[model samples]
Target chain A: MIKQILNDIDQNQAEIIAGLRKLIEMESSDGKATKAQEFVLKELKEMGFMTECFREDERSSSQVDYSPNRF
Target chain B: MNEVHLKWIIPPTDFEYHPEAYNVAGTIKGKGTVPSLMLFSHIDTEAENYFGKFENPYQSTIHDGKIIGLGASDDKGGVAMMLYAVKTLLKYVPQLPYDLCVMSILGKHGGGFGTLSALMKGYTGENSIYLHPAETGHGFAEIKNISLGVVDLDISVKGKPGKLHDDLSEGVNAAVLISYLVTYLEKYNQQMRDKNRFDFGSFKGEPSFILNVGTIEAKGGYGGINQRAKCCVRIRFYKPLTIEGVVEDLSKYLKECCEKEGKVNFADVIIERGSFRATPAQVETEDPFVQLIEKKITDVTGIHQFIHQYHGGSDIRLPMLYGKSHCVGIGPACALPQQNSGQMEWISIDDYINGVKILASILFEYCNFDQK
Candidate 1:
């Protein structure tokens, strides 16, 4: 089973690299992964996966803050 | 003298957080067979321009069979592998037996809040693997079962404008004062390195703890002497050293140093613990989930998977700390800074594809999907 899976992945290697390029070039270092995520959202949506967006705000997802210390 | 007249130092915070990052999760529903699994990677990249500036950090330049860009190896490669591995799984076996969650969170070197948000939003699984390529340069051959604790410290010394002074007890040069503190810190760091040294694993023969002075800042232009100077020190320590425990020991050490200096009060030297402030974590290497992945790695790459207890902080610690999930980290091959110059961060193309292949196999078994 694993061997077959590996073979199939070998075939998709080109597409995988392409997608990776698109993601890397989009630039998300500033924490606003808007462009890169748009690509992700599109890809997942096409795959029939359940997708959701969560952003940092005062109201949502702030209850447990495992924050990094910074200046 | 350039000795500083004591002002005050702000103590360190427990940790830090980001405000504008995003956490995106895509899930393929499972058949309620067994506990669900998650493959996670961070999206955000850091400008770790330690050696030199990474020109066009996001350009996605490919050279000599490797892709060079910021986050290329650290996680972007992992993200790509996870994303495509899921695609391969669904293409080969659509009816997955268990849930598979793929997450791309803002796990910047800034820390784990992006992941914390997802867990809080209830997007976690019982078994989680963070896919971040090894900086150990061992490529996909090693697995991270251990994560180091971190405490980022900000040491600031108040500056006072002044001309040249030869022990005249006049204006305070913050830079000079900080230089003095650096000597103490260096001596102390050497002591730290001597204890808890490692004999095996990825960082063999090196100290389990590392205190690196990453950055120092003061006014740059003219008349800048009066401005406050600050130094950012990062400490990555191994187990048996809790963040608070390290903090207590370090605070005491600094207090003692300052009092002995006498020219500066410990109050005048503020060392703030800014980031990470996390504890070391270990997921059993013998965990069934990890065993399954390791077996798949060997089957896919034909390399004996060496489990490396990373002496550094990672998001794998996130799930263990917050969600109590078992964790392991696997990824492709990438070079570390100072090893790969100009284009500091990059991933090997062939290794990355194989990483995807290995992950695909893991997901198939993880989802209870049978051979077609």
Candidate 2:
């Protein structure tokens, strides 16, 4: 079953390459990752997965976040 | 004397190519050549937290017996010390048994780009040291080793979407699921600390190793249910727990939690890797070169110095990876300066001058100036 999944992805190599190029061209920086994320969400939706997006200010996820001061 | 130029592999959008960054190095020849000793310092500063935004990041001033500037402590101070030490030593000694080289490198902050380039160009040495700021018991300290490694990852979790009015059993909440993983990992890290697995040698601090979920975002309105969420995590770790090891544990944990019978349902979780394999580097405490450094610092400062592992990594780690010499870190700073925080950073003028003295003493002692 895993082999079949791998083979299917390999067969669609051209589509994968095109999608990667589109993402690279988008030039995501700062908080602009969301703009590129929309492209990913669109692809996921077309593949029949439901999706929703969020940003940093969304307080719902802050409680579970861990912030380290040092790099 | 040679100036090394590095052309950028990936140029910024506005320009075709940036001016070649350079590494400056000079060496003083010895009378009876045997092996060489090297001193290294970075020439670059963390210019901006985020680029394309305007801020007076470079303005500097002198205040309270200190030099205040952006890269004051981070490296420009060390650079000054290295050059002055060389000039004084050349004027006084004129000849030695082993050649002494002073190097100033670029790209120490971004990655070990300049150091790695110098290594590729064969600028390594037999015995080496680096100057970086660290808090010491006295006004100076040397690092036993630096064992901190880093990884940044982006993860997305997906589940079936359901209406808000529906019962909780109808769909999986990404927020809840991610929280579970976070809690588990936190406990795991604490357990590791308890077992002394996160040992920091002589360095003293709380949470010697850290795992941080820097940012997380989940979508869900009061009346609408969301099916996806994303998070970014950064982990700094010590030896025996590498980036790959952490990722492997995470993968195994996810499988055990979700794939078992009667578990919470999630269609898939994807992990996007960033800086996945930057490992830590260190030198043994008992090496002869290290012992000599300890003796020299003690003799010059007349204060007992401490040998400890640094919590952070630096370009000094690059030499150790090449296995050419025993690399150690020593610098003259009473306290570490603030970096990357748009604030005026400073290095003590006394400490800076003393640093030059300490380095000169070490170079003179290590090269056996008495014989000359």
Q: Could you tell me the lDDT of residue A46 within candidate 2?
A: 44
Q: Measured by TM-score, how close is model 2 to the native structure?
A: 0.68
Off by over 4 Å in 2: A1-71, B1-20, B27-34, B48-56, B108-110, B135-139, B142-144, B163-171, B196-200, B203-208, B219-227, B259-267, B334-343, B369-372
Residue A34 of model 2: what lDDT? 31
DockQ of 2: 0.01
Q: Highest DockQ: give the candidate number.
A: 1
Task: Output the lDDT of residue B299, model 1.
Answer: 81
Report the C-alpha lDDT of model 1 over A1-71, residue by residue, as the tens digit: 66777887787777888878888888676555767777777878888789988875432221233233310
Worst 10 residues of 1 chain B by lDDT: B1-10
Provide fnat values for all models in the order shown.
Answer: 0.52, 0.00
Please, what are the lDDT tens digits per residue for candidate 1 over residues B115-179? 76787678887889899877667776778888787777778887555555322256676776777
A1-71 per-residue lDDT for model 2 (tens digits) = 22332233345434433332333333232223333345444443443322333221211111111122211
| CAPRI quality of model 2 | incorrect
